[model samples]
Target: MTEVAKPGVLPARPHFSSGPCAKPPGYDPAKLATDVLGRSHRSKLGKARLQYSIDLMRELLNLPDTHRIGIVPGSDTGAFEMAMWTMLGARPVTTLAWESFGEGWVTDAAKQLKLDPTVIKADYGQLPDLTTVDWSNDVLFTWNGTTSGVRVPNGDWIPADREGLSFADSTSAVFAYDLPWDKIDVATFSWQKVLGGEGGHGVLILGPRAVERLETYTPAWPLPKVFRLVSKGKLAEGVFKGETINTPSMLAVEDAIFALEWGKSIGGAAGLQARSDANAAALNRIVEARSWLGHLAIDEASRSKTSVCLTVEGADEALIKKIASLLEAEHAAYDIAGYRDAPAGLRIWCGATVDVADIEALGPWLDWAYASAKVAA
Candidate 1:
């Protein structure tokens, strides 16, 4: 292949890391509310901001009143772990692993918790058969596979009359998709994901069933202070109402509130989903136009609209690194490298925060990087 000249025009914003992803376009850190800074998280104003953030999330998610939403520590991982530790001992466990995050949960269930969960696994770009899930077992799965760019198509597979609770690790799935809340008893996400807010905090949404499990069932293993959700055998209702188990970063909460307010200004969840879909569509156009590029997830139905991974034809690890480095050095892209655990390729964030123009501009830079890198190799 011949050398392709470096693209002169760059993306207006090249901030596409899959996690701690691109911030909302036109985001000004200076614009974030500073009143909450240095205030005690337990103070009246601090609690109000937290509750307001939760309320905005519920509104955006269209969450039912039967469900409860709370802010937790440790990002999405913490929220999900808190759910698992509190709820899994009441029934059998089933874990579906399709990507790195899913695999981590499987490890937690099998090794850390010693539950010997029924493990159903699939490789990158594929999903385990939803038809095989047993409803009697407490089931856990990632609603979107962040590392592999695969997502569950819909909630049709979950039985409405299932006996066990359904837990969804929805860090990348929320906002980008219309989540069926009735099908999910427990769900977790971090503001840093779709909302592009600061990290170190997670949101946990619990249906009535999950709350019941927490109030009735106790894990055989000792519960960490951060993971405890019950007080005196009753659900710690305060936690759900903005009393977090630990002190939270008021700055992070303020940033999240800003992102949530931004989301509201742009037409709520539907608008956010549309933005992500458009960005994904734009990237897909780039992939479709080039023979050298294709999606890691072959099936369109299960592909992720938020984090979209691309397979480079005949590219090895070194080649993938070269493409990412070249684009970064040229200020055409940043953090566009595929996950370390995923196959060699590029993983571009197509979440709501990214602009479609950036994705469209990215195609030319990718072309230059790939063509030049191939020549260099």
Candidate 2:
């Protein structure tokens, strides 16, 4: 391998983590100074801020008025668990697992909940056959597989008149991809993913059908206070009206409000999606020019624009880790290693919070890192 000169420029902010991703450009901790700390979340001021966050999210996502958006206690995991616990027993379930998180859901269904769900699975870098899904059975799947970097191309496979509800774990897909709200009955996302906000909070969106399921159907399993969505045979309206099940992180709520405002300033959902698309396109160009580096997602249609996974030809896990360490040590990138269970490679976050210029700067650093790793090997 020939020695390559170190790149002169670096990404302005070297945070490329998949979760708790890079904060929005110009993010300052002091901006959250006005957070209603040490105060009751039910206080007028605190409630107003919380309501503002919900309103902003609804506006940005173009959610229908009939949908109920609630700020739940746990992050995406908590929100997803709540949905599964509350809704899965009402009908037979079909779970599609392709990666770590999706597999986790399948485990929950088959072992924990003992729902005995029909499981459809695919290996890493590929998606399960959507055509084979039984929509008559309540379906659960991740919108984008963060570990494998593959996403469902569209919602065309979901029938309009289907009897079952669709629960989508869209933690990594929101803001970066277009979600077919008409097809999704329950959707969950975390503040830390594409929004570049603080963690410890999950946003759960329930369509009218989901709400009806909650009110009309009762699960056989025990319900924790945190997981309960209906009370007295009726939907808990206060939860959707900014009244949380438990005390929330006021600081995180403020940070989420700031991120949402920033999202709106950039032209709401359309602008955020465009930014992520451009970042992925920038990196995709580099991958196309290099024969060694290829996308972990084999199908271009299923490749994720947010968590962009790449595989280096003839590279082992150690080699991939070495390349990632080289980039981090040089301050060119951070947190670019693939998920532990994923194929040996790199995973770069191309969410809206990541600038296209930074992704462009990363190309040269990756080349240098690969060469350096090869020399060391």
TM, every model: 0.99, 0.98
Model 1: per-residue lDDT, tens digit, 1-377?
Answer: 87888777899999989989888977898998898888888899988988998999999988989999999999999999999988997999999999999999999999999999999999999998999999999999999999999999999999999999999999999999999999999999999989999899989999999988887887899998999889999999989888999999988888888888899999999999999999999999999999999999999999999999999999999999999999989889999889999999999999999999999999999989999999999
RMSD of 1: 0.7
Please provide, for model 2 over 22-93, each residue's C-alpha lDDT reduced to its tens digit, 9 standing for 90 to 100: 999989989875748888999998888889899999998989898899999899999999999998888899
lDDT of 2: 0.92
TM-score of 1: 0.99
lDDT value, residue 265 of candidate 1: 92
Worst 10 residues of 1 by lDDT: 1-10
Q: In order, what is each prediction's RMSD in angstroms?
A: 0.7, 0.9
In candidate 2, position 110 carries an lDDT of: 98
